[model samples]
Target: MAGKGFGRWTVHGDGRGLAPGAVVAPDERLSWPATIGIGAQHVVAMFGATFLVPLLTGFPPATTLFFSAIGTVLFLIITAGRVPSYLGSSFALIAPITAATASDGMSSALGGVVAVGALLAIVGLVVHFAGARWIDIVMPPIVTGAIVALIGLNLAPTAWTNVQAAPFTALVTIAAIVLITVLFRGILGRLSILLGVLVGYATAWIRDEVDTSKIGEAAWFGLPEFTTPTFEPALLGLFLPVVLVLVAENVGHVKSVSAMTGQNLDDVTGRALFADGLSTVLAGAGGGSGTTTYAENIGVMAATRVYSTAAYLVAAVVAFALSMSPKFGEVIATIPTGVLGGAATVLYGMIGTLGVRIWVQNRVDFSDPVNLNTAAIAIVIGIANYTWVIGETRFEGIALGSAAAIIIYHVMRQIARARGTSQEAASPASAPAGTELNRGEPQH
Candidate 1:
């Protein structure tokens, strides 16, 4: 038997009282029935989120499911089957996808997303070898928090806009989520997001808002239509700016997963990133949009404490099975946008709150001029100049806000250091222990 580590598990005897180094084989605790049940739960929890990017970006929902399933499996294999991380459709790429698609077509937008995923893998490798401290220095909470808040704040308008189309339906959906989340306890509360979606979907059905006619029209089972990249200059130019933003978002997600698993994940970060990158490439090739790590699933992990890699494996298999079935995909597609809007109201706000939580956890004091200026200015600049232009190409939306946050935060940090009283104090050599200057390690 191997000793237990933070992220890695050790084999143990089944109440046999064996000594150390005793060998024990893996068991089938998650029976077939249980596996299917748990897997279905995961699917339901993430189904809405998984297909959302395609619907928003004008890509095929079936293709999204295909890559998502493949991505989840790849992540499991790359992480040495230790981390129970779930890779599904990511909301982070929505801004980038929208920007890229507007400039070029869906193909080019997908290529950009693939590039972003590759960048994430590279950054993950650096973090793995160098350590989490490097991430802290590069993307401090001040910067990350601002970007996260901006991500949510920017999407606020869109959420409201969608709801405005069907105010009553939206309200009913929102109320359903709130009622389930607040009124229910235990497992029910944990599944409030899914439950809320169900209620909103039911409401849409009753109101004749859902269009099931297409569901029956879709094929029962079909192959995923793949698309090849053209590498057009205009598309590449437009996508470059947003790539950095998506990469930044990926970093935040990796950090969140690390915190959830109580594992540094630095050792296998590169591999995990590679999985994400490759998945995007696969998605693009399969006529889908960019794929990213699902944050909602991370929340599920935290709430359930069910960190089992097997569960995700089960989910991947199920997702793949559904992807090959057009009828199933169409059923998922019928979920009303108004319902999604209402659920997003909660999720988007929660994402912002998570950013605030990270800031609070880091004990960031806003009273300090340096801290306050960095946070406030970054957020304001991020929202204000939330658009980018270069030559004939342009990138806008969440990407702009995310990039602005990073740039502003760095500039503010530099200004704070420059205004210090003493040269030594301002210099990295004189920095206090455990500060970013020392890469988060205590000095002897």
Candidate 2:
């Protein structure tokens, strides 16, 4: 039913419990109580990273949350709930936003965001009509895997920075997550990230790492500060490259969810992109950070094995409510860096692993030097946080790595095929198990 995609979620089983090895599908939900708990878990999973983008870029955190929640709802509707994702403040926009704000002010930076969003929405429309086949031709399993893996690995330093702030607290959080997964059964075990953060937060509080002073001064209810965008053609260069990163992120998100849920979500890729673009446009029009599909929430879904979009809807509503109350947002913002570091320690690594899982599932033939080198170069570039600057425009790790993966894969493959050396020189018998060298046109 169309309603299933909108409001009416079919209860998974009796809506009480998930049987062993069974997942709650996108259109299905557990009981209201269980679904709400899962939904809140998704919010917790997203909160640290989502808010951090705005906090770092000097955007209002509550305002970012407000648009993030709205973006998520738009994504659900646009995709007809087939894709489970949360539109959080995208880290890829950070450099450009900072530069734009520094030179042209916050409103000018927002104008850059609106420009990117509009462009992305246009790309989404193209993909929706033309189909995602070009994506496969351009970004085969090897390239896709490289992009996905590098994205997570690229954030390793950010996690380390937080760990350095409070090593002991970070360690405790990590240990809590590890133990929770094995020590408990069912939902308790699945919610290790949420529970681990709580454990970490308690530890931080006891160790005097948390400050409650701001919470008391915050209002119980109020609107987040909003600002209108003003377009500057000069800033467009800084923001345009971001569309490439957002495209990679959105596509990787669809691929990741498809792999995890055993569902083919390629058909919804355009809708996903359009939804996020629309969300970002809304954010830029008001005062909020530009949005992208979040990998942190992907980590949560992997751990919980629940792909229900219903939970995402619940999470969006909860986030929207929290955005309306400064006190609530402040309380959440008080989550110590150490706790985030610890959770990120687990979540970030999981994201990298998902990319590898993509390779494994697709049987990517790394024996082909083209495939091997693509992953090799891109992953290193991303993990090392490579940067290239062109005047005011900057292409960071994710952008550089994503571009390198596509360029390297196609250029190398085309050259190799022209020379009739598509297969590696090594003996076929020496190829790794479950991998085969393709001598003909590559098939995704």
- Find the candidate with the highest TM-score and give its number: 2
Model 2: CA > 4 A from native: 1-4, 424-444
RMSD value for candidate 1:
6.8
Q: Give all candidates' CA lDDT scores.
A: 0.62, 0.87
**Cα misplacement distance, residue 217 of candidate 2 (Å):** 0.6
TM-score per prediction, in order, is 0.77, 0.94
- 27-101 per-residue lDDT for model 1 (tens digits): 111444434444555676577778767788777777788888988888777667645556776665666577767
Stretches > 4 Å off in candidate 1: 1-52, 81-120, 130-132, 233-235, 259-263, 266-268, 296-311, 380-385, 421-444
Top-scoring candidate (lDDT): 2
lDDT of 2 at 9: 78
